[model samples]
Target chain A: MIGDSVPQGDNEAAAREVASGPVIHIRNLRKEYTSVAGVIPVLHGLNIEVMPSEFVAIMGASGSGKSTLMNILGCLDIATSGSYLLNGHDVAVLDRDTLAHLRNDLIGFVFQGFNLLPRASLLDNVALPLVYSKVSREEREARANEMLGKVGLAKYRDSQPNQISGGQQQRVAIARALVNRPQLLLADEPTGNLDSHTGNEIMNLFKELNERDGITIVLITHEVEVAAYAHRLVRLADGHIVYDGSSHEGAMSKNPTEYSAAVHSTS
Target chain B: MIGAMLNEAWVSMWANRLRTILTMLGMVIGVSAVIIMQAVGQGAQQEVQESIESMGSNLLMVLPGSSTSGGGVRMGAGALSTLTTNDAEAIEELPTVAGAAPSVSDVAQVIYGARNWSTQITGTTPSYFSVRNWDFAAGAPFTDTDLRSVTRVAILGKTVVDNLFGDENPVGKIIRIKNSPYVVLGVLSAKGQSLMGRDQDDAILIPITTVQRKLASNQVAGSVRFIMVQVKSAEAMPKAEQDIVDLLRQRHRIREGAENDFTVRNLTAMANTAAETTAVMSLMLGIIASISLLVGGIGIMNIMLVSVTERTREIGIRMAIGARSRDILLQFLLEAIIISIFGCLIGVILGIGGALAASGMTGIRVVITISSILLAFTVAAAVGVFFGWYPARQAARLRPIDALRFQ
Candidate 1:
């Protein structure tokens, strides 16, 4: 029933219609988990579209299935029902290995915990994703070094993750995510584990990467400050998008139901 | 991709050096036990084989009436002597018979100047040397004329020479046997031991005529205790044994309806039985050692399972980045194989060292064969693949989302 709603107004759709194609397009996506209690549904026919080079932030409370959507967008998990098209290819039909290839070739992931291998050197950690891509050693090192420099951590490449500060470790994870030069970057609570200062610094870096590299980014965060960095904001409430509009407008609106003004294009 | 997996596995294992070594201990002990047992078993078999070969080929022992023939030639004491040299001479003329020598043995004191030694004195014709594959160290053996004329000539074995002459050449030297002076004909070469662990070079050889007439005079009218027969080939052994039995029976004037007065025993069959026994022993040791290897493999499997559980986050991160199930499987399997290969190398060294130590400390012969080492390595590889597979599969089967969510 909720799939019929287009939360954004006609003007926003008219603006996005000029882009050649959508990088991510999902229709009636539903996911379920079986437990001893019964089948617990996580997503209820959620639908969304993200265009190329678009920076979209997803906001929700803990159980609103924002993380589940991020997983599906990154190709890490499949929807139990619905169609997800990544790079114009249906992800539901792709096998596990092929999905892995799709993720490797097109998507990058950043997590709240940094997710860097603690024992590996910063350089090695950054080069890890390229290893799965079967990149040559010399090429992997060259590309990893370039990404580290881009993240402003070039001098500490040899240092281990545990030896670095939390902010620096997250930057290293960003470098790793970008090392594959993936077309889409997916970040889940990228600044959730940091202080306000370090978190702002990271958000600025993401903004710079999105603008300068023209890389499409889908970020999931509940904080208003973190979501404000993205141009477009998508708010999920009970497994459906309650607000889809400008990030500034979404952050200023205190209550989700108030997004009706943006949805209906009314005062 | 596989190379990267191998590098990842090496790095992971090296990150936990102490744990890796501890987990490898079981494999080390198991492989070492297998190697040591195989070495000792093969060593024993080789020693037995050498002794069996040294005892000559296609041999048969002919015993007199009312005597039982065991694996070796048993000299009956106080039994009536029924066979003579004439019977041996007649048997040698048969088509399958190569040569035959009638022999008599007695333990007597031998004196060379002031040095005196009590040793076994075997009396037989010169044909005994060929039939028993005996060789001389110094001079020639006594000829046929010496046996017919009852000449006092003797051939001393290595042990007798060492005891009576102290490294001197005993040939042409006069030695007294039971107070009768006899000229030493030659010194026999060293023959290590028999299948029954008897020293083959500890006695003396003298003419049968001389021993029967003067030194041991226990026999009645030129009769001897036993005859040694050598067949032309291994295939002729059974027929030659039968021929010798019939010839001896006819020579002793036994009727067709009556039981034979002498028994012919095939020495080759006895040696074969000894060989088979040692082979069986070697196989048994190998089997027992493999059980310990199995235990070691189980230890590897257990430790790998724990490692997979502990490294769930690492697996998730790799999978999120883009590692396939096959890549994860290769990574864990490579880790297991590396541990076991290193364990096997250390085990081989320890096993060889143990075999050498056992040989040095004790008098038992130990042989370390290359085939045994190869067999151990093959088994170790098999164990690695066998035990490492299950844990690797588990690691590969983990869902990326669940693993990433895991604490």
Candidate 2:
């Protein structure tokens, strides 16, 4: 049921050989939106493979299709013409309910808005996933508390999202994401609403979680400094990858003016 | 899972306290109206039944009904009296008959001291009091000797004495009835108002022989107005009524297929008719009150829709955290149910209070039944579930992408 079941280019073998196997596999992914005007192609023939326990960042300017790619990766949307296998399950073949289960059990998402229920306590927000998983209330609370402690917000477990700072709320979101112990964590601009220092702190927490707990993370951001925290960087230009390499080399190649020109020429 | 949903529902409801309370007010008023209206209808029914019962149980009346025509001038019932004192005696001798009294009545001006009031003057034997379950409030009732002697003694009803005497004792005082002087023998107790809204105590009673001989002697001689018969028991009313009809027909020599001159009326049948009318009235009132509950349910639906729209982002966040559509539906539905349950509780208390307050103000006995409370509570809960379904479904059907992006 993995995307590898479909014949892909030679890059599949190279990606599989990097580790035991890749946690996220997408080949020739395409997405098109239809409105009253006509069909607008957003993502076109893009390929991305993420290995287990790796911290990867996707960087692109506006209209470069990075958000669309992140939505597909998070199982919130489906590819129009492509194969996406999330932890060995083919995304396109799953129904809506099964896709929800896949997202719940295998993937956790963090948003730039830090999408936590405004009236819920930090503990309740973190324990929500386990409630859907049918976990006992005591165990759910225990695990939620443990995750909060990991993020150093255990004392603020009873605090509501509005009562906390944006950085603290983002941290609570991180705790909630990790509470289920999902294999893949998807964050779309996790630090977009934070100051530079708080953004650095959030990135460092991600780095620590990746190194200490071996949790795979895929983050999407347009800021180079934010992307710098990732071990690997994948840059998108007009719905196609322009560079996929080490963060330092990718940063060196990411010239804003040149990238915008290249993006315009492609569209 | 349900417990968790309920917790979430309660939390969400508490988040907007004013809106929840305002929404619940409709249900509260609706439930209370239902109970108060039902009580009023039931109380009216009871009042009618009691008034009929006070007239006396197992009682029957024989009336002269056959009209007479001479030269195309038809005389109505009692224009020519077909009922006589002998018919009353014959009815009393029947096996099921308890007692009978021959009665005649006329509207006359009564005079005592400087006061004069126009009231009904009923002339009957002493047995009329027992037959109608009436008792003397002061002095004593006139006996058979008074009837045989054609004594000018009268029994005054409470209202008649109050109007003519103004709280003064009337027993043994001389009064004028239709210009004929008579002594008040005793005062009858108050019987309140009849079901027809007429005053029952605005009358006086004297011997039938006196009325026939002195007052209405020119109209019909030795004839009576009607016969009041009391049966031994409630079970004997029908048999006694039939016996009276048969004996009267035979005595009048009413041949086969010939119309009888007398009519028999059973108090028991009249009582049943009154009871049936009351039952139907209460049922109708209950149905009308329930419509207000339906309107209250619609109010719930309206507020729930607004809540679902306001909490779109919250729903998306929960869905992102792995909450299914059913989970979202259940949460909102539970919130509605909690509101309705609390509303119903407060409504029940207020309804009973309102009923008692009405009873106090109107001097009517309002009955609050357990079945009504249960039915009202159950309907309230059902309304919550029914109205909550559509809005909850709308919330559940929201796409996570759209809801999360909602402003």
Candidate 3:
């Protein structure tokens, strides 16, 4: 860990006792899509940082580049320009396989679809990340069971994804993500497909994980209700962040336009 | 990590058990076909080799002549008495000529205790047994003293002994040939059948003088049928043939401008032609086996490609969850290899059963070797891996974002 290399603002120090260095450091990050039609630019000149254990949400409309940013943060894709440093390792310098290990070791991802391998049991799905990390079966099972117990799905470890409820599937996916004990959890619309009640439960589990285990979480969503679950919110419009501040203001009202206009003017 | 990949593959394959077994059919047939054909081909090859050995090695047969032309009248070969006992003796004296046996034969009714059978009766010296590499099932061959004294001793072949004596041993038994009593000296061990399908084991052998004077007395003085000459080694066969021909020509008082009165044929060469034909058949079996394997490989490739396409999203999920590209490749390839190996196991069992059944039904000697089983296994596995590689690579190359976005 990069100890004390972070330049602390007095207000930040006052906010939380300068938790080791920032878990994520980004500078001028940009992404582009190339097709036969033409080159399409998505993210343009983005800079952000997330401290360890910080609960942040990246909110955006479709094609607003929040998913692209989340992808970069999860090491699924690299920025076309600019640089990213996750846990003090330069993201751009590592090769594809090394970046995969980085993803396995440092970050965990939760997708909107809850992509658990359907043929695998919940226990196997939860232990899958440890397989890539080459963890022994007994140890992987123990850690996976512990994570499942933490997510309140230990008894359903033998169930298949289809056999479980949508909320239980999401919980299994969360257990899989946390099974590797990654420092940063990047979730892309973690509750996008769920009913409101199940979505709130998943959000509460994320909240509890962040608060109790000090796990850094960066979530992507368009819904204000989901974004409100995080302590901090970063809103993207067109390819730039329009707001980066308290989630309370971002989700102060259920009306989408009130939060959007306020974020546009306030940031 | 590899264990995990295998586990994942097993789970996936188990979920699609019917598809897995159906896909294995191609491989099973491929491996089994090769094994069966090889068993049959090698069986035929072994039969030919054994027949060749039984016929004796390094042999050259000096027939009487090549379609005799005498007094402006063409006649079949051996119509003239071109070979004699003296010629056989002279050929045997040559450095490369290991042994020589001149024979006179005739068909006659043989009888013992009211049991009668018609069989070919041959007369030759004890050297004929050596020249033919003949072994006795019982008793012994007549010696030089029997040949000199013109004793009526006979060695019965398996078929002859079986007809004459039934379950009784024929050694030291007396049977009448042409109403003359001849003692049974020994029984020749069975040689099954010749390449020409002749029952070589159906004849009886006696001394040349005894047979010529008593049973088949129409021949001219000192004249005989073809001379069977055995050479010292295979490499000396050509030279031995030349020596036999030159000695015969000189002994016949034939002039330099005259055509020779005898013809020499390389018996081993003729046998080798049969062997070469068998080899070609074995080669054909090998080619067909390889073609089946190739077809099986294509089947594997096709199924793997379909599976990859159907499970593209699964691949994407694994990639997003931190599985490497090599991990995906290894999983697919491992699945193919395991299926191929299992298929080979089943095919081997089936092939062995098929071979035994074929042997039991057809009565041809069937040979199933470990090397044959190993060959089928190694080649089929290689084909599976070779064909499985491209599809696995296709799965591995899909970009995570694009793959994850696949509907």
lDDT of each: 0.85, 0.85, 0.86
Q: What share of the true interface contacts does candidate 1 keep?
A: 0.61
Candidate 3 local lDDT, residue B254: 84
Model 1 CA deviation exceeding 4 Å by range: A1-20, A258-267, B67-78
Clashing residue pairs in candidate 2 are none
TM-score against truth, every candidate:
0.92, 0.81, 0.92
Task: Give candidate 2 regions above 4 Å deviation.
Answer: A1-21, A91-98, A255-267, B1-3, B56-60, B66-80, B91-101, B106-193, B199-221, B229-273
Tens digits of per-residue lDDT, candidate 3, B179-272, equal 9999998888999888787899999999987877777868886788888999999999878888887888899888998887788899999999
Q: Residues A75-183, candidate 1: write the lDDT tens digits.
A: 8888999898776668877777776766766789999999999888899899998888788899988999999999899999999999988999999999999888777
B1-407: candidate 2 lDDT, tens digit per residue: 77778888888888888988988988998898888878888788878877786687788888897665676765666565888988888888899988899999889998987899999988898889998888789999999999999999999999999899987888889999888899999998888777677888998999998988887745477678888899999887777878888899899898999777878888667777877888898888889889988888899999999999999988887777777788888888888899888888888889899999989998877888888889889999999999999999999898877777788
Per-candidate DockQ versus the true complex?
Answer: 0.59, 0.48, 0.63
- Candidate 2 lDDT over A165-214, as tens digits, reads 99999999999999988888999999999999999999999999999999
For residue A105, model 3's alpha carbon misses the true position, in angstroms, by 1.1
